[model samples]
Target: MASWKFPGFLIFFTLFSCSFSYTFTITNNCAYTIWPGTLAGSASPRLSTTGFRLDSGQSVKLTTVPGWSGRIWGRTGCKFDTMGIGNCETGDCGGKLECDGNGAAAPTSLFEITLGAGNGQDFYDVSMVDGYNLPILALPKGVYGGACNATGCMTDINLGCPTELQVLGGNGYQVGGVVGCRSACEAFKLDKYCCSGEFANPNTCQPSYYSTIFKKACPRAYSYAFDDGTSTFTCKASEYAIVFCPNSNGNQKPNPAPASPPPPMRRPHPKGHVVPSSSNIVLLPFPVPMLLLVVSLSFSFIVERPWPVI
Candidate 1:
């Protein structure tokens, strides 16, 4: 009888382990509300909601089954009608309140992830390959594995945004100012900036001047197209917290660089700022409340975990 029971127990455990869901908590730490957008991968399941509002200090959690992979971005200064149709300053998905499966427009920071990815590990990264709107952080909770946690951009890049890459707008407020920053690819569509054409390969596409500036501001983030070594991280957490404007002041005010140099300006653009002689360049400006969506993870074991939730 004991031998028969052991077989049944083993079968149950295997089934449960094979079908576990991971919870993701998206928190808004900025001074204003944000609309978080989600784009499911081609093979991944559709999310419960593709986009939704996340007010300041609020959080929301969503769950995904194993093998789920995709990206998440934030949209600020969004305005929607009663029908839930509208647009945003940055990370707008076809100007729709609900993004569905479409990717956000360029010049928006990105958080990409692949669960149960290669070598039985989950790969995640905070990328500025598109550009930057808000400071973001992706942290693992109670994860037991290698160094796979606490990676994101904490510095407000818009404060020091190059004049050419500045996105000036009301930024969901009454006053107009610099709301976000644009990537080198968006600012100048050259092959080197976009890492396209002959420069697609990692060897040929070395970091350029603009990428170097971004790297100096946020070392943990992907500053350029081929920033794989320090940018990508691996982990095995049952849950993750994706925080927008993480660890910001309580006021949640949007920090827009002054249009004109302030009389008492304290910070200035870095040395060798790129200035486009052509004035037609377009600068584009660029989510969620969940307390906690907990998932039971019986696989937790002792491992050399290095970082805490950031």
Candidate 2:
């Protein structure tokens, strides 16, 4: 009986540990096919397949052990031969079908996550810091915490991307020759735009004109390096569904209306002072009651204003 007890306990422990593993259900809702790529962080384990073809309207589920950390992005306009040697229009990884350990190229939107162990909260975000290739929506299911809210960039930013920062697609690509939107850093390679060198810290680095455009279009996504106040999300989810080109269902939040004009570029404050920048503003959705109250007040103030004689 004593000998049997040890084996029974061991089996139970293995099963318990396995239960903590999480699943990522990647779906392609775009009209065309896209190859999804996965890149594990330096300290994390690689997934089963580094990359694979995901046809339109199809979905694939990948499992990850507890505490996994990685980034996933979609590759478009790929044409690989039998040998799996080829390139993609956007988000290519060393011109290969399987990324292996390679990361996605710039001008690619990324769904980045670090899963928690056991019941710990997971941190996740959809980042455009590299740039924008395709719109993505990440929805967490079976959330253990109250903070599990859907987040992603659902707007096709390429339509409004500046000419200088555009990535033109090849012969078969869509959207009038433009495909991806390059980051200011990718377009100019300046330390001020890249948030490197003298501007490495948040106090010294603020959103540039270009990043502000992305932030306005996709308020919940990471537009630049220091866009954490509104972009980062945390939850303890059993699984996450990452949908590429998500359809305009009611679940998806509509993009905010275009602002009158972007704020002027903010110069970094002198070092050692913690001045707040636009990137630090928390732009989360307001509760319905709060939103209504704000609108009512604004309307009342406008009505009360007296017209001045010209």
Candidate 3:
């Protein structure tokens, strides 16, 4: 008679898939305070807060579900009360600190994103369609695919804004003293610049004189209503950093990652077995190969019993 214990089974299994939450770290490098306003698209979840103040050199980290979509912009020169009511010189949303799904006012630099969009990709862009109030940059992290690229208006467009399109701030000022730049549509209100009526279609509406000025200043941003060829950027990234008034030193040095990373994604195992933190290996107990061997051996042993040696 021979006795044998079960052999240890070695199974190669694919790592369990986990759900990931995307992160957005908004940083302000401006010399003044900026009230960041956010608005979620239809079917998207609102962020932790709709609006908040970010002082110079300060930053805020926000986490959103993978499929969330939204837009963000800075509201300059805002005066808010204890009740969260306020007015902003630009990008005001209902005179409140929190936008609560309200869109920012026109002539505001816009950063928009659709996370985990079609085919697990993110579509993002900085648009001067409304206008330009501040410089912006969208930096992607852990990017995959060739589509990953940085997009934003790093230049201070207000400095070179045309006289007619310049939005002056503070006391009376001369050329090169503007704080914001108005889009052609905002400045002229023409059907062509506004992309309305006869010029509503892509073929009909084209970039205008004012739009050309903006395009030359901020080549990466949307200068007109249908400026999409180079304005929009796409990528698959784990996180993004949206910076306002990024330094123009051209160094583009790497900065430390945000202190808070999104929570680890998890998936429930069928057997309710918890995964060990130390290992990335996933074990499947009683795999098909081992189960079949056990069944075959049991049948052979039963057949060879010889009817109790009768």
Q: RMSD per prediction, one decimal?
A: 12.1, 12.6, 20.3
Candidate 3 lDDT, tens digit per residue, 1-310? 1232222121112121233456777877666778998887765667778899887667777776556766889888788999999787778899999898788886788888767643556667788788877878777776777435667776766666666776776622222456566777767767877888888766888777666666666666777666667666667897787777774222232231111100010111012112111111111221122232223223211111000110
Per-residue alpha-carbon lDDT of candidate 2 for residues 176-291, written as tens digits (9 for 90 to 100)? 67778888887887888888888876788898877787787887777777776777777788888788877433233224233211111221211211111101111122112323
Model 1 error, position 11 (Å): 3.6
Query: What shift in Å separates residue 179 of candidate 3 from its native position after superposition?
Result: 2.6
TM-scores across all candidates? 0.79, 0.77, 0.72
lDDT for predicted candidate 1 compared with the true structure:
0.67
| Model 2 CA deviation exceeding 4 Å by range | 1-14, 248-310
State candidate 1's TM-score: 0.79
lDDT of 2 at 83: 86
Highest lDDT model number:
2
Residue pairs with backbone overlap in model 2: none
Which sequence of candidate numbers ranks them by TM-score, best first?
1, 2, 3
Counted clashes in each candidate structure = 10, 0, 0
RMSD from true fold, candidate 1 = 12.1
User: What lDDT does candidate 3 reach at residue 306?
Assistant: 9
